[model samples]
Target: MSKGQQWDVVSGVGITALAVAAARAVETGRPDALIEDPYARGFVGAARAPVKLPTTPAEAEAADGRGYWAQVSTYIAVRTRAFDDYFRQAAEAGVTQAVLLASGLDTRAFRLPWPERTVVYEIDQPLVLDFKLTVLREHGATAGGVHRPVGADLREDWPAALEAAGFDRARPTAWLAEGLLPYLPSEAEESLFHEIHRLSAPGSRLAVEAIGNIPGALADTAANGSVRTLGVDLADLIHTGQRPAPADRLTNLGWNVRTVPATETAAEHGRPLSPAFVERDARYVFADRPPRAIASSAMSSVIRPPV
Candidate 1:
């Protein structure tokens, strides 16, 4: 795999999932998990990802630095569960529309017990989507029903492509920006939200996994600054670029926000968070519309699931 393809970003999640797999391994002593996802381990092993250490220990360590891969495992588990909860809540609230932005190798549609008429739209790079679909078919995994896979770069004009693929943005939408925004430049991050806000309707809900606090925050020393000072680096294993805005940027954009620390999110999921997972506040936002609007591409376009 090349360094910076959309597929490459998929690796971070893979590592996190594989960490979860390790947890699963510790729990069940099974190579095959109910997530039954052999892919997580296979991908890491095939590419030798875990073995590829960063050049400088500090740079590698300074990065997402999953040196504490075990700790990261807890985070991935929490995030995946949180998003799933958001999806279930949205469904219970009678909102049938859900769009996962930058939806890498996500298999939620296949795993979750979605309500009837629920549609899960996954958008990601063509190559990444292709790899996942091929693997999924080989694993005998089908989305069951009402799943739309739109292959496109989120940085480009994906809204048009999404509409063409049958997304109904005017209705209530449960939107997710998971494992994405931090990869974008600060401006690009803003643009991404503006685009989302543009598309959302009155009852729409939005959730984000944003970097806020970290354990090192309370340290009297300044290694990477404070716990809040360091956020997720865009690159995994390798240090690439930086997206410097704090997690609070979302609030500035006129959306209601909720901040949840790793500890709180862990407790919500009924898990004991490791110390590494603690020491900082991450955000899980819920933003609704003002019951008024300027036109957005999603608002004007009428779409239904391409079941």
Candidate 2:
């Protein structure tokens, strides 16, 4: 489905963002959590619709099912930690500019201990970003870096919006597209990377969490009954089937790419492993645009997905 002209906290793909916030809030409450997002709980609290956070395996099962939701929670927790490390490494390497594409409820701009001179630009639907900012403001949350929010649809001219919001394309940037691509059609996904390749300066780092083909459990409407109880369908939100390979695109764009299995990341963090992790084509990919000269040109646009 194409993105609508507008969306709120509980409609379309926006609702999935709330679910992700819920997962993050629950994870932050964990004693052995890989990352702590203090704003996550507040975001959930401020949501227009009730968000059922999975603070424990029991809560997860109650929200979805005995096994599937538990696995989803573990997967989210693992994904959060891995992406956190990606930003840290980028900062340690002296890349001060960060761009979060389809940022959703991500609070990395406020939570992570960013190096001095770091500037983070978040790009997403206008209302989604507005809701997040409103909650953070109400809770008196402070940012760790220069946080700039660009309210624009990714399907449109978001790069222009980003540039207007003080994103410097000349500097190396740390870019993230987590839990995002599966919603876009294959052609849109490819066009997205093409834009990223054009906008990235050498030494830029990119991280993504994606599934080549959505898992049967998440794609099965009947199986996701527990998720439906909360008024959000995990399966319905996702655009399933084959899609563009981001790694291959980045490689052709002169970036060095590395991919790690989601299960391996979970194992490294000492988290539980489930078939959901090992029995799927899920992966966390990292690609770095090397410190070299880049061609000064804008990429030609391809056909946009059917609107």
Candidate 3:
């Protein structure tokens, strides 16, 4: 991994910036909040330089200081909170091992309290992991349980990288695909999860998030933001084996699947979104891996701490 520098490359800087902004919004106490992530504040402090806002005046203006970026930040914040709640609830339900794929700027392993022997693995590009490590060390933040940082790309030989870093696939895992899929190519995602299913043991759990309908009718506000639709096919991003059906999707691929709504989870967790946000239909989901049907463990995925 590159030495301590930028943790987020790709559009991840945008995503990380959104995550940071969302953390700020949630801390500010928005009424439509889905979950609370107090730890997000630290990532702002971790930055050694000022963040570069978007180039165009409209984009820049909307990106920050309470405009378009503010709206994007709020959506990202609510999503973060809901996903955190999902993982936390999954942990409480007894899932042990966790691997956070593309663990960009996420602080879950440190902020989330876990079972005594819980082990967390974080996978991301080398430089990304290195940057996070530097910030976390400076801030004196540590992983809640046994934490391992596996610096590698999901599109590469991350499986070997993880195994070298002490990942044990036999344990039940709670997988998190938060704020990552949209950046990847459709073909890469298939290879990615094919490995995930291959390495996953029985009783593993999976939680996923992805880009939603960006058509104006779906979310007019979302269209005004710096975000892009990720321009990938839904079937590849959602399910490769099952067609379009949610209930039968994961089951066809060896896991029990349930699609949870961002709006619903928000309300259930006491953070109600405005009707406008719901009408936008930003996509998010929660799924659990059932016991392996055909046994052939291939590889799983990473986790990260606050920067």
lDDT by candidate, in order shown: 0.58, 0.78, 0.60
lDDT of 1 by residue, 152-238 (tens): 766678889888989887887888887665455555566778787778877787888765542242231134322222222213322
- Count of clashing residue pairs in every prediction: 3, 0, 12
From the highest TM-score down, the ranking of the candidates is 2, 3, 1
How would you encode candidate 2's per-residue C-alpha lDDT over 1-307 as one tens digit per residue?
A: 3654677677778877877777777676677877788887787677766445554545766775556555655677889889989999999989999999888999888889998589999988899999999988887888888889999887777888888888888998999999888777776788889888888988888998767657654644345463554466667666677666788778888899999988788888899667645655678899998887534442224434566
Name the runs in model 2 displaced over 4 angstroms.
1-4, 50-58, 64-67, 215-217, 220-222, 226-230, 293-307
Task: Provide the lowest-lDDT 10-residue window in model 1.
Answer: 225-234
- Give the per-residue lDDT of model 3 (tens digit) for 193-227: 77778778778877777445434322353344333
Off by over 4 Å in 1: 1-67, 213-253, 290-307
Best by lDDT: 2
Query: Residue 65: error of model 3 in Å?
Result: 6.8
lDDT score, residue 302, model 3? 32
Better of 1 and 2 by TM-score: 2
lDDT score, candidate 3, position 35: 42
What clash count does candidate 3 reach?
A: 12
Among these predictions, the greatest TM-score belongs to 2
